[model samples]
Target: MTLRLSVISASVLLALTTHSIAFADDSAFEVIEVTGHHEGSYSSVSTDSSTPQVDISGLLEQLPGAAVNGNGPLTGIAQYRGLYGDRVNTQVNGVTLASAGPNAMDTPLSYASLVNSERLEMTRGIAPVSAGTDTIGGSVKVIESQASFDEISGKVAAQYQDNGQRSHLGAKTNIANQDHALLVYGDLLKGSENTTSGSGNEIAPTTYDKNIFGGQYRFNLGDSGNESIAIGYQHLETTEAGTPALPMDIDFIRSDRVKLEGIHALSSWELNWHLAYSDAKHGMDNFSQRMKMPSMNARYNNADSASFDGAISVGKDTWLFGIDSQLSQHNSVISDPTMAMFNVDNFNDVQDDTYSAFAQWQQDINQWNWQLGARVKHYMTDAGEVSHSMAEMMPAIKMLMTQFNNADRTQSQTGVDLVLNGRYQVNSELSWIFGLARKQASASYQQRYLWVPMQSTGGLADGRTYVGQMDLELETAYQLELGADFSSDKLTISPRVFLHRIDDYIQGVPATDPAVKMAAMMMGDDNPMQFANVDAELFGMDLAAAYQLNDSWSLDMNASYVSGERRDIEDNLYRISPPKVILGVNYKSNNWLARVEGLGVSAQDKVSKTQFEQRTAGYGLMNISVAYDADSWMLKAGVNNLFDTEYEDHLAGYNRVMGGDLSPGERMPGTGMNAWLSGEYRF
Candidate 1:
């Protein structure tokens, strides 16, 4: 059986040699969200948090129309509101991960591991249709460090930061009674090289190294146990990381994951299921972690991907039904290793699959509270048959590789989605909500198997160089949302507004294939681009608030704004993320706590002249923190940009490596002034 499943996946990744921190009992949670509409958790990192930063969507971007494009230091990428990347939808426990380079640099929440997470949330606004199947830039979830039922327990943590002397360590262990449980974890992070609070230098390769291990097993089945099961395994390791807006960096990324879940209590519809599998092997170079290029512009790459996912659902009371699927495969290769006849074949045997079925309904009547959904999807794609240097180059890449290896690359499609939501409870502190949807997506095999013109496009880090388009179709969207939520007793609030009207909105135009713009102007790109399907529109608004001026002070705020455009011309919508705001002030006692925060932004000249995208200026920063606790132990301290401010974070990208202090297209500077501390203990 494949060597006993590879020796139980290498003994659960060498017994969770990465991260873990679940002391598991300090619990008390109560959420009644509507913040942006269905869920919008946005806070939770507990492990005696102190932030040596480990990008889990940049720590959920402190939530409010979240954002984070950042192309390095673990490859962030997760944007909402005005969409982003593969239009967001990142999950972990419920699987749906897929991303092995292709420019993403192994993103997919970089295989989440934030202080031994146990449910990282975000679902804000219209993610219905059972929350799967291409969630138009929305939905984020993660779960780890679970399996409890009595518990043997454990915990450990560490963190340190001094502008890029960063270091972190984590630990976790567990065992349970009441029907079995087991868990494990590990983490280690390292960094060096990072300076720039308006230019203090450093920046050669914003260094990093990472690792995260995992384990899980849960049990109980039948004999009136009503059934239950859980099994998981994980391993992620990244090395020599540094992605100066990517052109190559990170000489390694190895990922392996497996999952299985179940629940049954038949007799009355109540069975759920899950299955997952993943594998990734990535390698990149441009001279291993920055600098050195020329020796025929040395470069190297090797990307691989494999994914499988399954889902099942069944509900009892208010009706629910489901079926979900996602399967993927990819391959990439490139070379120049001192020109061994210079290779290529960027992608081959690519495949993409998705299958879905959904039905949902919820109710509450009386002051209203409905929900309805419907979904149907099926998409399949294929590719294979490609060559390069095994055949050599030039001649407009031999007329686009002989017209894409003689066409007919197979395809299939069928999509449909619908949703409607509502809420109203007008009184006892008000409430109201609304949502509508229609979504569809397809075409990603690097937008249909890239036939040349590089920059791979999956990460769309905007260093533009695209090429891929073969009768593309299926890209629909039509959404709307409106919101309100208010609560008294220490005040609370939420506000939202949204709109979208898209149609075949894939973007990146202007190539007009003259042999793909003469092979992208012979590789110097004088304006090249492809992957059509246009017409777009987006609108936005956001707000989240809190206050509790008594009982040891409190106050909070979050704001957002979005705008996209291109109703077939007149541009805008390449990186969307302009207005933003955040504020905080807190204090507590009887164990100590403190906070001070602020962040502001607003300057994005709505660029994107067909992916020329660039324009950002506007900044603000301030942060502070403190914590205590004790009982089992805890401590934390923080200082982030507490006046080291030097700005530039318009979704940090650009500056494709080149001996650095940033100059190659600038943008990509933010982070300086750092001071962190963390500690934890429990047993």
Candidate 2:
């Protein structure tokens, strides 16, 4: 039942299914239609690799430095490149997802399944301005199938994991005829999991149950290909047995989203417009027992947002513009035996609005391709809060409390991005590319409405609150990149290097209190402190290559290295980024494919003064996967962490009390040896 054992079994199952496959003559590296572009064009080229077929969530887990929070599938939030929450942007069918709070558990786009997607695109760093300006990490855009000739097209898949005694089943169908199209997808999953780590002793057996469902409809407007409307809905529910660090007695979530978009192409220019609305509610039951006081709490969160986007293109140059807005509200009331006399009730609401405009020019000269682009964006946030004493509502103990006050806050900022890129052919064997970008980050909601926890004396004490000073400046970054694409008859390789400089960083400071000591220990510099014009820099490189040694055999490799540091005199800094490397190889034949991958992370000497920081020793992990294609059917199986190696991902953040040691649920624990078997049929 161990995670390691499950991974091993999965590897064996994959090896048994694969046979041999012949290599095709088609180019492995070719430009394909991608949705990362706001204009919906194929002119943009990206280095992201795609699997033969995969779920949307599964595909995201494969990104470098990414991790999943939940035990099973489809229910967890994705932490990409060490960034989580609002730091990453997600757009589905031209609809953006933003939350009211910074908590990762309340992410907006958690879906039931993605089987009906026509295509999906992942772009890092440089995303389209229409996608919004908050994406400092990257962006993910999904394109669903809106038009189809078939009356119905669908598929079913299932997988079982031995380590956790887990099972998953998912299905999706698309029905289309004439002017209408309907697509539906759903998944059911259950898993009982155990961990193996330093905190394994404290780690308890966890069980997972989940269900997700979604549907979409499309209506056509004439045959001009310029007019159409679509609407979609997504819902998911999940329950976890909880962990030692944070126990969850109950959890439930429901969401609904709809979108409408239209396109018009005239002789002189092309026009496109989209509108979207979403509503979501997250309910949770949590029990926190620290020291003598045990607090049982239930919270209900409601969120809704809307957006509008449009673009106009003329000749080789085009200008695009859009507006994005969101509203979020949260309410929580706790029942505590020790703090019953204090009586606490918490409530807050926030709204964010953004507007942006961008221009792109694409020109082809001789054998070289050139691109130039610039985007300008303005961001604003409004927030307010209301608090009341439980005694005031209850008949038992009536206590006078401060009346609700308008804790109103307002902030505004403007930033711009400039990009320049070009590609040149040196010969049949080599091609060169160069790209440079300058990005600026506007003031976020957190930077303006600063709140620090007050020492406990009663329900509500004079909490230290400070209005954001206008002295704050926008953060900025300048980056330079160079890369090469090389290929021979049998082998293709690509390597790239990037350098970045960032300034005007903000960090939090801690308050002096005995009760908050434990909380402060885990907080590090994450507390809402002061903002300073600090400087930081990072440089990294990555390479990917594949070679066909013979007709039925081939090899593949991928690796990345990153190093970063913050130069601030006020305080010793934390490692915002760590050096990481991933190397993988594969062998494939007609009915069989096998792969081995290695993940390695270097030591991070960066540490904070109040925290006991130990440099994570470099560790490597191995994984393998394989599949077989049969007559009108295909069977796929795989094992992650083939070696059952105990290693920690460098991108992990801290929450556990154990110092420096890897916790069972701290990072994405590398499963020992797990196997999965899935069957697919094609018509």
Predicted structure with the largest lDDT when compared to the true one: 1
lDDT tens per residue, model 1, 1-683: 23323332332232233211111121111111233333222333332332456655666666668778888778888888878767777887678968788888878887887667754566777787777788877677765567765579888877788777878788888888878888888888888666455457566576778888998888977545558798889899888888788777878899888898889977888989988888888988878667784632787888889889989998888888989899889898898887798788889878888898998888789997788888899998888988778344478888788889899888898989888888788987887888888888887888778988888887767787888886799889999998877666766666678998989888778788787788777778877788888889888777665666667666566667788888977888788877776666667667776777767776777878878788887677888877787788878787887888787887877788776667877887777778888777878
Predicted structure 1, TM vs. truth: 0.34
Instruction: Please list all clashing residue pairs in model 1, or write none if there are none.
Output: 18-186, 18-187, 18-213, 19-185, 19-186, 19-187, 20-171, 20-186, 389-392
CA RMSD of all predictions: 23.3, 8.1
Cα deviation of 565 in candidate 1 (Å)? 35
For residues 1-683, write the lDDT of model 2, one tens digit per residue. Answer: 23323333333233223211112231121112211133222112112122322225444444433333342232344444433344556666656654322233434344425444544455543444444455554566666555443367776766666655667677777788767878777777766664343223322333456677777776766574345666666665655533222322224455565566665655556566666565555443333211112232333323222333333333324444344454333333333444445434332454556666677765657876666777787776665653435444542222111212333356677888777766677887787767777777755444443232211111000111112322357767777767776666765665567776777754333433332332233323223223235666656554445556576555544444444556555334443334444444555566665556665555455544422333444556665666666555566666655666665433333322222234423543434555556555543
Report lDDT (Cα) of residue 328, candidate 1. 87
Clashes in predicted model 1: 9
Candidate 1 lDDT score relative to the true structure: 0.75
Shift of residue 599 alpha carbon in model 1, Å: 19
* Alpha-carbon lDDT, every model: 0.75, 0.47
